[model samples]
Target: MTHPHRTSDPGVRARFLLAATAWTVLVAAVLVAVPLTFAGRLPDPVASHWGPSGRPDRSMPAAALTLFALVWLVVAGTGLVGLARARGEIRRATRAWFAAGLGWIGGFLIGIQAVTIAANLDRDGWSRAASLSWQVAVVVVGAFVLGALGRLAGRLGPDDAPPERERPGPLIDLDPGRRPVWVSTATAPWAVGLGVVASAAALSFAAAALWGLAPAGWSTALPLALAGVVGLAVSSVSVRIAPEGLTMAFGPLRWPSRTVRLDRIERAWVEWRSPVQVGGWGIRGLPGRATIMIRGGECLVVRYTSGGQLAVSVDDAETGAALLNALAARKTA
Candidate 1:
C-alpha cells in the first residue's frame, strides 16, 4: 500500500502562493509602517545589537536597519516561493508546511523589528535602549502561534490522497555461506559549496569580531556557523547494505548514522524519487516516513514491519534493493 508521488492541484498551489505572498507583504508593510509611525521619536541610530549584559553595544541608522530587515524578509519569502514552484508537483502536507514556514519567518522577523523599534522608541541614544530578554521570548511564542495558524489556513482545501502503487523488489538467490555487501555514496555539490562558503563567512566574521573590527558580529557568526554545519551534514552520505541491515552514515565524520535491522524490514524496493516528492532536499518527511534526497534519481526504499518507510537516494539502487530483499527473506526463513 505504498503511495505514489503526486502533484498538487494548480488552484491549491496558486492559492497557497497568493496567501504566502500576501502574508509576506502584510508583514513587510507592518515592518515599514511601524518605524515610519515613530520616526519622530526614534533615535537617529537605533540599537541593533544587545550584548550578554542586555545592553546595546552596536547601532545602525534606523532607515538602514529597516531596509535591511525588509530585504531579508523579501529574500526569505521569495526563496520559499521559488522552492515550492520548482518542485512542480508537491504533496499537500509539504505545500502547507512550506507556506507555514514562510509565514513564520516573516512574522518572526517582524516581531524582532518591532522589539528593536520599541526598545529604541523615545530614546535619546542607542545606548539607552531597553533590554530584550522578555520581549524576545514573547516574539518567539507569538511567531510560533502565528505559524500554527498559517498551517491551518494553508490546509483549507479538501484532502486528496496520492495514487497507490506498490512495487516489490527482486530477490537474489544466494548460498548460505556467502556474504554480500553493497556500498554507495550520494553527494550534492551545491550543498557542499554552500556549506564551505557559510563556514568561511562564519570564520571571517568571528575573526573580525575578535580583532574588534566588528564587535557585535558574533551574533551573525553564530548562526552562520550553525548553518554551515547543517549544510555540510546533509551534503553527502555513505549508504551501505550488509547482512546486519541497511546503514546510512551522514557527512564525512559518519558519526551520526541510521540503521534498519534486517529483521524489522518487511520489504525493500528501488524507486525513482525526486526532491519535490519528499519536500525538497536533505532529510525530509516525518521520522517514520523519511527521505534522504541528495540528488533526484534511483533510491533504495526500505519498509519496516511497523509500516515506517525510509528512502535514501544512491547509485546502483536496483542491486541494493535486490540484496536487501534477499537478506530479509533469508533472515525470516
Candidate 2:
C-alpha cells in the first residue's frame, strides 16, 4: 500500500551520492600519489600491524600495499551503494558517517605508510621518530573527520510522522468481559539462514586448522562468536498486550524488553509491509516508526499521540490489532 505522506526528496539522494563519491576520490588520490612521491625511499616489507602496546607486530611487503588500498576503495564503493538505498533517517545520517569512516581509513593508511617509509629510508626497521607514535596523529585526524561529517549530516533523529493511511473498515471487536491480556510469538526464516552460514564458517575454519593453516587464537574466538550468532538466530520473540500497554521479550532469557502505555496510542490497525518500509526487520526504529518484525506478513500497527508509529509482526495480528483499538478507545473515552 502507498503511504499517504511520504517524502521522496531527490536532493537527499544527491547529497548522499556526492558525499560518497568525493570521499572515494580523495582516498584513491592519497593511495596513488603518496607512494609515487616517495618512490624507492621506503623499505621492501613495512610495518603494517600494531599490537596493544602500540608497537609494530606484523609487516607486509611494500609492493602488496596496493592490495590494501584497493580493498578500502572497494569497501567505500560498496558501502556507498548500500547506504544510499537506505530509507528514512537511516539514509541521511549513516551515509555521511560512513563516508567519514572511509576518509579516516584512508588517512590512517597514508599516515602509517609515510611514517614507515621515512623511518625505513636509512634502515630496515623503524627509526626512533617513525615508531607507533604516528597512531596519535591518525586518531586525532579521524576524530575530526567524524565530527565534520556528523555536523554536515545535521540531526539524525527519525521523522515525527511516517507515511501511513487509515484503514477504511471498522476494527475487530473483542469481548468486553474477557481478560485483557494477549500473547503472541514470532519467528524469522532469515535468522535460520544466518545461523546456517555462521555454523558453516566455524566448521570451515576448524577444518582448515586440522590441516595446520588456521590462526591459533581463531580456534576459540571464532567458535564463541559463531555460537552467539546461532543463539540469537534461533531465539523467538514474545509479545503481550494488556490494559497497561504492550510488552515485548526475546527468548527464554528475555534479556531485552520494552513496554508502551495504552494511553499513548491514538490509532491501531492491521497492516502488511515489506522490509523496505521499516529498514529490513528486527527491532528497527526510525524517527516516527518503530518496527519489531520477525517475518514480513500481517502486523499490528499503532500510531502514538506523539506522532510516532510502532508495529509488531506476528501471528493472529488481526486479534491483536482489534484488542489494541478497543483498549485504546476505552482509555480515550
Candidate 3:
C-alpha cells in the first residue's frame, strides 16, 4: 500500500533496486503457479457463452488481470529508474512513461489478436495480415513507451529542480551558460480535445465488442473511432524563453500557430479564461481575442508594450505573469 519514494543516492538506489527485483521475482512466481494450478478449470477465453450450459464466462478476465499485473510490474521498475536519474524533469518522464505504457499494452493486446489472425491466413486472410502488422506495431510501442514515460515523469514537478532539491523552478539559477528557457502548458482546449477523442474511442470499442453481436453492421464505425485516437494524439507544447519568444505547436501536422515576443509587451494581466469564452471544449476554433488553459485555473495574458497580446495557460498564471513583469521590469528599471 505504500508508494515508492524515488532516491538517486548510490546507496539508496542500490537498496531500492534489490528490493524491487526481489518483489518482482516473488510476484512472477505467484503468477506462474496460480495459472498452472487452474489451467483448464476454465474454457478458452475467446469463447463467449450465453446459455446456462456453456462454461459460464468468468475465467478469462481473471487470467487477463494476472497478465496485466505482470506487465505493470515490469513497467513500474523501469519507471523507478527514470525517477532516479531524471533530476530535473521527473514529471515529464513520468507522463511519457504512462503514455508509452498504455500505447504498448494496447499494441500488445491488439498484436496478440493479430498474430492469431495471421496464423489462419487461408482461413482469415485479411484479418491475419492485419494482425501481423498490429503485432509489430505493438512490440515497437512497448519498447519505446518506457523511454517516453521517463521523460514525462521527470517533468512532473517544478521546471528544473532536481528530485532531491527543495521546490522546483520558476526562478532560474543565473548562469550565462544556460540560454533561453522554453515551457508550455498542457492547456484546457488541448485537454478537452483529447478527452473527447479518447472517450469516443473507448466507448465505441466497448459498445462494439460487448453489445454488438453482428459483424457486418458494426463494421462501419471504425473510421470515426480511429479519428478520436488521432485527435487525442494532438497536443500543444509551448517553448518560450527570455530570447526565444513564444511558439505554440498544435500537432505533428502543423507548425507553430501563435507567437508573442518578449519586448513588445507594455503590460500584462493574469486571469482565468472561462470555457464559455473559448466556445466550450476542444481547440477547433480560436475562442476569443485572448485565451489559454491547463494551469491551476488561470493564464498569463501579456500585452505587448509595442504590439498585440499573448494568452498562455501556465501552472501559476499570477506567478508567471509576475515573473514576466519582473523580467521586463528589470530590463526597463
Best candidate according to lDDT: 1
**Residue 54 of model 2, lDDT score:** 67
Model 2 ranges with Cα > 4 A deviation: 1-9, 32-40, 50-55, 70-75, 87-106, 109-129, 153-219, 222-245, 251-323, 330-333
Q: What lDDT score is found at residue 22 in candidate 2?
A: 80
Give the per-residue lDDT of model 1 (tens digit) for 1-333: 434543335577667667767777787777778788899999988999999888899999989756845675766565554555454444567656776776677778888888898899999999999987888899899889888887888677745565474488878888888799999898889889888999999999999999999999899999999999988998888989899998999986885998878888888898777775576789888888999999887888888888888899998888888999999888888
lDDT of 3 at 138: 54
Q: Model 3 reaches what TM-score against the true structure?
A: 0.34
TM-score winner:
1
- Which run of 10 residues does model 2 get worst, by summed lDDT? 154-163
Q: Estimate the Cα RMSD of every predicted model relative to the unseen true structure.
A: 5.6, 6.9, 15.3
- List the candidates ranked by lDDT, beginning with the highest: 1, 2, 3
Q: Give the runs in model 3 whose Cα sits over 4 Å from its true position.
A: 1-10, 40-55, 58-70, 88-245, 253-330
Model 3: per-residue Cα lDDT over 100-168, one tens digit each: 444454345434433332333233222212222344555666646644553454233333223342112
TM-score-based ranking: 1, 2, 3
lDDT of 2 by residue, 227-288 (tens): 75755644557778898888888744665787888888777787775454455557787757
List clashing residue pairs in candidate 1: none
Model 1 has a clash total of: 0
Residue 94 in model 2: shift from native, Å?
5.4
